[model samples]
Target: MRFSVMDLKVGDRTGSDVFNWNGLLVVSANTVLNADDIDKLQRHDIDYVDIMLRYDGKSPEEKPAAAIPQENETARTYEEAVGGIKLLFQQMLQEGKISKELVDQSFAPLANHIEQEKDVVSLLLTLNNKDDYTYQHSVQVGMISYYIAKWMGKSEEEAVFVGKAGYLHDIGKSRIDNNLLQKPGRLTADEFSQVKRHTEYGYEMIMKSQLPEPIALVALQHHERLDGSGYPNALRSQDIHPFSKIVAVADIYSAMISNRVYQQKQDLLRVLKELHQLSFGKLDAKITQVFIRHMIPNFIGKKVLLNTGESGIIIMTHPTDFFRPLIQINNQFINLSDHHELEIQEIYMR
Candidate 1:
């Protein structure tokens, strides 16, 4: 039977082989459990395992998993925050307007947790949802923006505010036609123009709602580029607000990794490379560098598929060359920086 790790007793045997989220063998079938084994499983973040059960009317005490307290609490917090955001969007669409109270409510539940999270990028990557892309994208952007703000040494309060701003940045998309928003093909020039208007729509909504000025600016300037290449205002580097710079990095990173109606999710490494390119003249170079340097290292220990069709676990990342990391393929180790021709094709997440 499938059982949460906490449900397994010290002497419990595995009924079936247990694998981790990456499809790696965690525990073999028929292996007896012990305290140490359970501890190891917890360290690997294995939430559940299949256990052999006796047909007799006897069982061990039903205890909770030792790891569940904090990690599961974080998961629950994120779920509640996403649900709140979803409802906030629904209300905005129905009413054709937003309120400061509703915007604050959408961001408040996740504030404390976002402040405490050390590696928000990894957490956000793990929590990414392919379904309900829009709502989840907003939540992920908020969490990521909070991390970037903190990385830039912003105060706790400022980081939280930036996160709230990120959450509401795309609220203007609520006014856009749902069919057009989710079309699974290339948009014509007219449709593209409609999509670009989300910035103005979102900006006006936040401004009218009486929210903080910076939050409204983030909505307005998120699509504005540093090189005068972005949409709407097309403001250059000096014209854009710092808050918008942070959100732009977060928004681009989150959207590239996320599956959209018209596009499949891009590889994380590839997305990071593109961000590096954009950082040169289009994006905030300092902010983008800070994001890539801190966030790329978290990919270590993650399983990945390579361009050569081989799958491996990331072992180490280069300090300067963020894209290529040392990976363990079978019993062999290959440093991607040394093998210039090969590249990471995809990253597997659970």
Candidate 2:
């Protein structure tokens, strides 16, 4: 079986001799690898190698199975995209500048996946990592932004632009102190004040990179709310760029549904309810409507835990009661619209 170097376990034995792109032998066959060897292989760009199957003391027909190809590929794709994002941030922090080409390269897979699949929820479900919140959040915002723009009937070029803007929106946070960013408790006023500067820092970085005017404005204005309730500038309504408005909605939605340093992830139904409330005064109502309309239906086939300690699969969505859906549990169908006492406690990913 062939496995990417990143997916190798410490006890996995090599099925073939490992070689570099230059065709020189690196490690002989049948060598047991440890953490250090796996890390070295990844650092040296030795992406994949054939691995021998576990040979228990049994008959040949009872050989241990290899990793599932589809599952491995899915895991690899996700890892590579995230690793690229992390590397991009690391490079930017070290160099004190943003690289437009590198940013494009880092975000290409996500953009391509969203463009090809046309389903943002599935992609969002794949990005549930809590350890790398910043990088994952950036990617999620970018992907959600792309879908929102596309759903709102924006041109393909315009949608892609907003997606790119979403991906790079939080680059400014890379400059903030890790202690402040990763604090497990609520930040003090002074710490929060410093945190807010990420917007200005991001704006400066994007502008300095000569990327695009809209992308720079997105970094600057994404935090600004319709009611002038946001930070850095607090420009409201017509003042905020439209692209930034799109990104703002995406950013809020992504953040609310994601696990972060200070909070656990919220249930999707609950997050949507909060977004609906925010739309009245804080977010753009039109964009919020378009987003809600497109997003709620995607939950039809998903599974959710109820507040009553029961789990079920969503079978149908109520048209007006967007949050209440009919569910199937133990061969019984329950319409949540009729069961006012019940609510979704958690959304399970596929």
Which candidate number would show the highest TM-score if scored against the true structure? Answer: 1
lDDT to native, each model:
0.78, 0.76
TM-score for all models, in order of appearance: 0.78, 0.77
Q: What shift in Å separates residue 18 of candidate 2 from its native position after superposition? A: 51
How close is each model in CA RMSD to the real structure?
A: 10.3, 14.8
Q: Give per-residue CA lDDT, model 1, range 85-199, as digits (tens).
A: 8877787777766776776676777888656444444576567754888888998889888878877878878998999999888988988898999999999999999998999
Candidate 2, residues 1-350, lDDT tens digits: the string is: 99987777765678987765534344446655654446546643688989895434354443322322233454455566677778767876887677878887777766665564423454566556546888878877888889889878887788888998998888889899988899999999999999999889888877777889889889888999999998788798989999898999999998988888789888877788888999999999999887877676556567789999999987666656777888889899999999999989888763
lDDT value for model 2:
0.76
* Collision count of model 2: 0
TM-score of 2: 0.77
Return the top candidate by lDDT.
1
